[model samples]
Target: MNLLDPDQKHRLFWLLQAGGWAGWALSFYLGATVWGDPPDNYGFYVPIIAAVGMALTLGLRWAYRLTWDMRFVARVLPFLLGSYFAGVLWMVARTFIFFSLFPEQKAAFGIESSAEFYSYLEGAISAAWVMFGWSALYFGIKYYILLQDAKARALTAASVANEAQLKMLRYQLNPHFLFNTLNAISTLVLDKDTNLASDMINKLSRFLRHSLETDPMTQITVDQEVAALKLYLDIEQVRFGSRLEVLFSINPEVKHALVPSLILQPLVENAIKYGISQSVKGGAIGISAHKDGDDLQLIISDNGPGLDFSQGITPKGSGVGLENCRERLKALYGRSQSLKLGPTLPHGLTVTINIPFSQEA
Candidate 1:
């Protein structure tokens, strides 16, 4: 409803046009009456002149629509020339009205004499400038709205694509994790450990149920991520039992900080796979998180044989968990988030993720 808003430019344009033409009519009336140029007329013709100017400009506004296609000179040039002629026609009509009203008065700016044509043409030239300015404003507003619409559509498409990618990455974890868990359960069954296999199956069901309940694109708190990771670690604990030593040093201040749903599960799994599973003694793994300025840093490190790569890149394995996490973070936060793999202390690997700290998704 704000008249000053660019979105309401059309309404503002009409209001300004009405006011401008009204001012022009009043100026004309004052010049005619005070100077006694048109036989001392009252303000009867002022309203008519204002109405005519408004109508003439409204017509020009309609004609200006075709002038936008500047590439086709044959089409655009005619509208430009016609607009100027329309202004001349408006002046001619006003001159005739004035001459008819004051028969005995001088006709210096009227079409009564061929000599007065120059004076009429001068008024037409001034009116042409007004039409030109109106056209410029109209085109400006039209193009601005068009550009805004285009940007909105592009942003919407990008958002939908990002969401689709996040969903794909989230679902990718299910089959991979399920296959590995089922293989472990099968090994326990082959060894005639029915009680341990039953427990693993129960833990796996709970983890899968939790994953299905939570939306892939929706973000969860660090505490929720930790809870999910605990469920995953519990399943691995059943398999590794005495060997898997897990530790959590989470900051209470960052418990509610937003993180992608099930983000920590893959990182913890990766830690156990490459760290605990590879070692004979099966070293300890640490999961910690804290708020660092405007960012939240999540770390998953384990005491095991680190990567052999000199550049410290976690090479893509048969499991696409790390790659999926990286791509998901990229889609969610663009370049604002990061995932880095580096050697932890003297030995072992550490996966550190830096993401913006927020309480909401």
Candidate 2:
């Protein structure tokens, strides 16, 4: 029932216009009945006066519409002059009909024919004030509708920008990971390990197919995301062989909880590249997810050489992935999500993420 909604503007305008004139006619009839000696045909005259006024004002509406885009100050004189002239026209029409219907009212007042011009002038002034009021109301409503339209456009533009930013951040990770996997496959091919290279290529194909099919702007359930991760891990396992180990400790209660699509891939990639691959005895990566009251908490940890902030050193290529994850989370959840990097129990790095717990419908 939003009358001001842009879709309903035309219907609302006509309804208000008819209703306003009907009220004006009713008030005129009631006033004449209470005080003045109304003629037997006064009801007929009232409607004619109202119809003439409505028709003249409709023309004024057309004129005002043409000036809608003008500056407010520039429009003032036009509105005033237009309303006054329309009012004079309406007054002339009403007077002709009134005197024609009941000529005796002129003689009842004992007014001379010479004074008719003065009476018409007085009536025109009153009609002008009425037109001025209508003009003010028309402008008020037009401005309100314009303001609402501006706000709606601003919100739509903001939403579009937000979606584009999220898509950019999400898509950037795919190419970074793709180049690494392709290089690995290349290495295996050069080493003449045809069997391993073939298997890695198959797994990489399935992973990429899934990645392409899922939209970057969508959220997937924890279980589905973990399934995608396993596909990725299959390819990585081929490259690292026995050197890479992965452990998943997912709570069944939170398996249906939702997270951004492909949210964990870059984090796992970082662990594999900077932690496990850096060690002679390649390390194990542990990923766990659980519900923490109203939040979903995910932790990815590795038992490898941890970051040494004391020496102001960080793993190469770590920032891009971590920062990408951080930005995506911020864009999706605003201030309600967090990503923190810290040391694991003994000698590794752990990335912890906290996001609002929401389940798929």
Candidate 3:
């Protein structure tokens, strides 16, 4: 049946090799023993020769894979051609080599070209068909093996996709979070200062608008997300005033680069909560983005309480924000991307996000 599957292919091959050798050797022994053939008839050389020929077929598919148009016909066509050639070579070479290697076997099988002088032409014609059958079986198994391998790969990809979809559904953003934040803004205005509350509301509106309007499939440009983050900081500044300040050193190339929706929102929120809020005088939050080969490197660092002391700085909430972002990244990009939170150059918290360019930023 299907032979190409990674598991089945090798198993099939070993089975074929072992079976073929056993069958061929048994048949030779039976015929020779029944006919009172010479002792040389039971030599292992014949089976070894046949096994080597079958091994050649295994590599044929790989050689064709590199050359083919990736179509079934194209890939199999070359392999078939190679299989035919290899089979013929195996048959012809093995017959001559083994016959010559042991002069006694040539006489035992009644196949000595030296003794025949083309006298057994009728028998030779029949023997040719027998060799052809062996060759055909070898190639047929390889063809089956390749098909099985393709199906296995497809199944693996589908399983991975299914898992990712489950994760995405589980972590899908909650609209209720926005509603709650809106209610917080309303309370801030009534129970707190109106001007500061107004600024916060305005910033919150921009952030909500950006999040709601972002293209779900094609990623939003990094610059757009950063611009939205700036608005968020502006509003938070109104609330924190002298307690919060932000500095950005962003690469121009990545501004238009693609990034997932609201990639920076919650991370910045976490930074503010732990970094500046914990500091007595409130320190600065630094944001930077750059290109690293095929990936975009984003660093968000804040001067706040450090983590574990030895590693550097720590954020306030033990990093629920970074974990959420990490979950989202795995859902979207799997292992193709990464998000890491650690200490910055100074005694502060730093969050690093690696976005792949091939995944479009």
Candidate 4:
């Protein structure tokens, strides 16, 4: 198992084994020297003992990586008994070979039993402790690394989702504006209002130029978005002159706050199409921007019919304009930012937008 896959049942199995070996080397000086309250006489054999224990763990980890159901008491129960027997076997073999070669230091076994039997049991228990310590450390480190990787992946996914939403908003903007301007041009040609048509065309060209020029990642100042909206309003006024009026009340501190480009135009367009166009007396669109604690709030209201929740429509809001704006807000700032639609004070429609703000802005 490649320990890197989080979804795998036995992820980090091999990684833990490698880490186990490393920990054993650190704790016992690679088994070249024994450690305890009273140092052993044969400290020089530490490396050999450490090496054998680590090798066994490495081999066993590969052979019997526990499955989902085997990870409980059943797996834990047999490990100690099996290790005890294995340690005793290895210890006896080493004791026999060493004592036969060097008859002196026969006292090294310390047990009345034959040197082979004594060494076998002693070495086994010591090796078992080393294996246990390292295995636990290895799994601890693996768990930590996995947690960090998961957080990084979640952050990356959120960033990608935001970029996708902005692209969707860009798609909504281009076609929506083009159709309206073309319809205006058609009306101008039919009425022969050549001068107004030329002016509208110029303003539309400038608005598009400003929008397409900016980098998508950069947060533009609220002033810039408002300027783009004004340019668009100028063009629309030529076609809807005497039918549209715009009133703006902006707080000085909020002017330099940042927002996505063209954020306000969609709301204003909704006002014009749904309110002013329908009323015989025409209507006024009021825009206000102010700071409320850590939030930057921008509101636009028009004296028109409010949203019809049952029908799922509002003054041209059923199209991509307002919905695209909502999607962009959700994507960029998530729930930290919000847009709300409701009835205006004197019987019109209002859209309120609240976004996080920086003191410098």
Q: Judging by lDDT against the true structure, name the best candidate.
A: 2
**Per-residue CA lDDT of candidate 1, range 279-327, in tens?**
8888899999998889999999999897765765565443588888898
Off by over 4 Å in 2: 1-12, 26-43, 104-117, 120-124, 309-318
User: TM-score of the candidate numbered 2?
Assistant: 0.84
Cα TM-score per model: 0.82, 0.84, 0.52, 0.72
Sort by lDDT, top down from the best: 2, 1, 4, 3
What is the per-residue lDDT of model 3 for residues 3-83, given as tens digits with 9 covering 90 to 100? 244775577667876786578667865776789854554466656765665566456545654765577777656655665
Worst lDDT 10-window in candidate 1: 1-10
Clashes of each: 0, 0, 13, 7
Residue-level error in angstroms, candidate 2, position 256: 2.6
lDDT, candidate 3, at 151? 84
- Model 4 CA deviation exceeding 4 Å by range: 1-108, 111-126, 136-158, 305-317, 359-361
198-310 in candidate 2: lDDT tens per residue?
Answer: 99999999999999899999999999999999999999999888999999999999999999998999999999988999998898999999998899999999988878645
How does model 1 score by TM-score?
A: 0.82
Residue 163 in candidate 1, Cα distance off native in Å: 1.4
lDDT of 3 at 220: 71
Error of 4 at 232 (Å): 1.3
